[model samples]
Target: MCQKNCRGDCDCESQPMGGGQRGTKCDVRILLVGEPGVGKTSLILSLVGEEFPEDVPPRAEEITIPADVTPEKVPTHIVDFSNQEQSAEELSEEILKSNVICIVYSVVDDDTIDRITDYWLPLIRRVLGEEHSTPVVLVGNKVDLVEYSSLELILPIMNQNQEVETCVECSAKTLKNISELFYYAQKAVLHPTGPLYVPHERELTDKCKQALTRVFRICDFNNDGALNDFELDRFQQKCFNTPLEPQALQDLKALVSRQLPEGVREKEGDPKQGGLTLAGFLFLHKLFIQRGRHETTWTILRKFGYDDSLYLSREYLFPKIRVPAGTTTELTEKGHNFLKMLFEKHDLDKDEALCPNELEQLFSVCPVVPWGPELIYTVATNERRFLTKSGYLAMWTLTAALDVTKVMEYFAYLGFMSVTNAESQLDAVTVTRDKQLDLQLKQTMRNVFHCRIIGPQGAGKTSFLQGFLGRTAQETDEIPRAHLPRYTISSVPVYSQEKFLVLHEIDIFSMHDVLTPPELHCDVVCLLYDASNSKSFEYIARIYKKYFEKSRVPVLVVASKCDRSPVKQDYSVQPEEFCNLHKLPPPQMFTTTPATAGEPAKVSRDIYIRLATMAAYPNLKRLVHVLQSRPSWIGEYTNQMMELPPEVTAWMKVGLGAAAVTVMGLLLMRTLKNANTAN
Candidate 1:
């Protein structure tokens, strides 16, 4: 029944083929096995070279085909055992060494395909052991002999067994789908979706154990050997980008409890002692990996109280309020009392008001109400001075009566949520203790433009920083002599707003282990060279080519000590020529001198200004926001309220009623406006 197009000899003699660069090579071993006369040798030859031999003789040797998918060529070794008279022990050893197993069966022989499930699969399972994770592909050779529909019948049965990764039908003689069969074989080995073995209660692999240990260490931030509720929430946010909801958190705790040993579970009965131990963490992750269920991990995270939205309901924040089933006035009174209690908790000094810092701390702990400082100032402040209990009550009531969108608009007006606002607020705060200003500046200026200064030793790089800081070149105390990099911070005005300019100065000669990828997350790079030393300029070029040639960040070239350069024999190239040669913009030429010497000789502030202007402000601003607004203990108490029973609490009913009224009022207003326009 062979097709008319079927041509080419089956050359059974083992022929070696090679291509690609010579070096350390990655080897992918493929073992092609089947019943006798399954054309396993023909498939390998067709894939190795699209040439189909007129007659492929039975071969016992291995065929090595070089695959040049990347810079490093991957050599694929295919061994055919169809015609080899090897013993079962020798065949098992061969199968054990393969990365991928290809089970081939001829289309013409229906019994050969049936024998695959009954004989070959069980043999592979016995040889590989149940634990080894090797990829297997079922390939049906000589597709031209029958219609594809006949082959389709067996495909589903093979897929349902889940023993093989995929099934592909091809004609070895016609060279049809031969290449695709090998490509899939390589893919199966390179990118497997899940682990091979499903472990029982007591079984786990070393690699799985190592992965669990790493995750446990990352989650256990304080080295406490266990993850508390807060730590678990933090881990969820880091991994899943959202904290678990209230019920999900409890479910995860229960799941961990079941996985723990009898002694561990007994001790976990106490609420305070209820957290995951190293064993429990490892066991839970192993279960998830074995089941191949990512949703289970996400479910556990959500239950830990990770939420995408920032806002929460008022009732969720304050559960103690008892709304009288009487009138709106009584409801307002109960809400006022709740606010009074909340304000007193935050007003640590009992001064009848909260400061900006205290207010920030209060919001950090409470469910986010979206009540910005401006609205709080208008409602909570008495005589525009302090946020009193009455102010807090009014603000809460007003927010409850409005829609979430309107509440957000009011919150946005406060402006303290931004890096610039936070910086300005910190600057305005009175420093009560010595060195507090330095700490405040460091904490507030989180969004900074990192400028790395690189130059040869004694190239006046340190002197340039000192000059930029309004110090003189002769300020010996300010100049650092350490071989390590020196860091300095300066507040520079950018776009009419202040931004921190952090400079890191590295000694070019001693930068072997210092130039890490993380250290290079800079906004600007400054290459400094002494005008009198030509070698300094050459070193700068080398550094530039090594690190900054493909960098997206701006690079500034500064030629220092222009005043000290020899007019006759200076080896430094002209700024124009250097710029043209390096394909860089024009360089800034400057000279630094002692403060007492002259005002005109100092380094210019314009250079720092230019660096700041070139910074990616939008990205830096977003980074600052993320760093500042990471999940905190603020609003964590809302989780406690969510655990309460579904019965409508008086406070919750009141809040819901208020929200419904607000929505109805907005709808009524829109309807009236529409009617008036129609009239």
Candidate 2:
């Protein structure tokens, strides 16, 4: 639906790759900034060799840690800044490139600790700005020389500045907390606590609360607005990959109940409807951060597609799905089932249709409703104008057929990846074989077809497209032009199979019959003309001769406004005679006369079925006409004969060879006689 992450501060309509924002850097840039002789290079050397180096260089030569060796599974680049080896300009550049900064100090030297607050901290603030998001960790090295913990002295400094994440005292000689110092640096960049928690307020940040609220709502499978036992179990298993113990789950709920008695919803008259409220959910995350378990909250957020900034990552939302030329996309069976479950969860009235309120609730998790008002007219709906279950799936089918990428994005937004346990939305789509191959094989496995509605002005082109949705002429006319839908689609039944038929009106005539690549390409074309206008047939006749005269795509000549008084066309031949000379089927008739009160809604679906049939078997146009012309008994008998065993069908074809040969012989004789008459 969008090129950028929908919730982030980006132009959702159009954005380049990564969208001008940094997310999940390629490698971890841990820049150590401190005064001279603070053992910054010793820390880097100890991390690489697992022991303190006897003779360390003036500065550690930019060491690189492989992604496999790190805890976060991302390559780490430890950049050491030494005033002796690098200038201030180089240091500033390194600071700009760093993802996270570490301010190292010596535990034995109180002067170095004083320099941390006076010199190093001020330098980073001046370079990266006072309100920058780059996290800073306070490192106290040479703890072996001190008998007391330096963390107590550093605690006050960590609280005074919001940029300081935490303080850790380590010994390079004893290798104490050496690896953890760098691990915390990586964790700070991947899952920063500044955006998620407020230490002073002892609560979750506003942005964190909003992100968790969305996650909780998506996991509310029953739409009860609370996470019950079953929902909690599913959430735990999906986020942490382990089942939640029954007692453990109960104990957790009891803790919430004890803290905030009203958080338990049984007082609202139903125990099942009440479990962990949204406020209680936020409270639990705040508790996690308060208890020094912020990683737990970060884990859940990452599993739900949030990055360090708490925006849904682009990689998680728009996974690549390759669709080759001439191949169309359709929804797989699993995709339909997932949407079915979602619909049922929100259909509170149980009428098998989604009312306006129900639909709004269904899209609560999405940033915006992906569809518009045209959706109601684009698919089948109930008499009350609500979207039926069939209409819901049909709308999705149309979207997947036309804009497959859009459908995939909305799938991620709707929690399809998490709820269905699928890696990406590509699993929900099936790309059909090329249309050319389908024609060469004399069959197709596709269930969707696109038909272009090409015609002149005043030919009722818009009315014709909307008529396929069962809308009448008067109802469509009442709607303003701006609100009128440009396209309409619905499913049509062809014998035993169902195919989705899409009708898109083309305004090529508005440009004086100028055609583009889009206007001339489609699975089928509907050449519509007004039967009451003498000049209407001539316009379509010229179009057919100019464009589709020799193309393989199927064409259907439609005579609209049949209910009006008929008029002769200003053309060489009438519609039927023109079609017959070209070996095409006779022009089909169409009308959109208003219905009487209390009458059932009805429109001509057979026309759409014919279009889909032609698209399905593009090379069998003449055979399709023959089948349509045959009586019901003959068509039924043909179907039964085709259903026999392959061996039996082969023998049946052999038995009919003599009659076929006789028909061909008579056709040859008639052609020869006609040629003789012409001479």
Please give the CA lDDT of all the candidate structures: 0.55, 0.82
Give the Cα RMSD of candidate 2.
Answer: 7.9
Query: Model 1 over residues 1-679: C-alpha lDDT tens digits?
Result: 2111111332212211111112111466889899888888888777766778777778646887766652224567788885467777778888888878999888778898788878988888898786556778888898888775445756655544554766788888888888788876765554332232222333544534443454454355444467766667766665555786757766777877766652123334655345677787766765764454433433332222211111222212222322222111111333334345546656777788877766765554223546543443234244334666654554444343322233333222222112121212122112122122322232223234567888888877776666555544664343344422255455567757865565667778843424677456566788888777756676776677778776655677887877685332233666557666755545666665544644443456777766665553322321222222323442453455577666644576567568757865775566445434533
Candidate 1: segments with Cα more than 4 A from true spot: 1-25, 67-73, 194-679
Best by TM-score: 2
TM-score of each: 0.29, 0.83
Candidate 2 weakest lDDT stretch, 10 residues: 14-23
Number of residue pairs clashing in candidate 2, backbone atoms closer than 3 angstroms, sequence gap of 3 or more or interchain: 0
Q: What is the lDDT of residue 509 in candidate 1?
A: 81
lDDT of 2 by residue, 292-366 (tens): 678788888877787777888777788778888888899998898889998999999899999999999888878
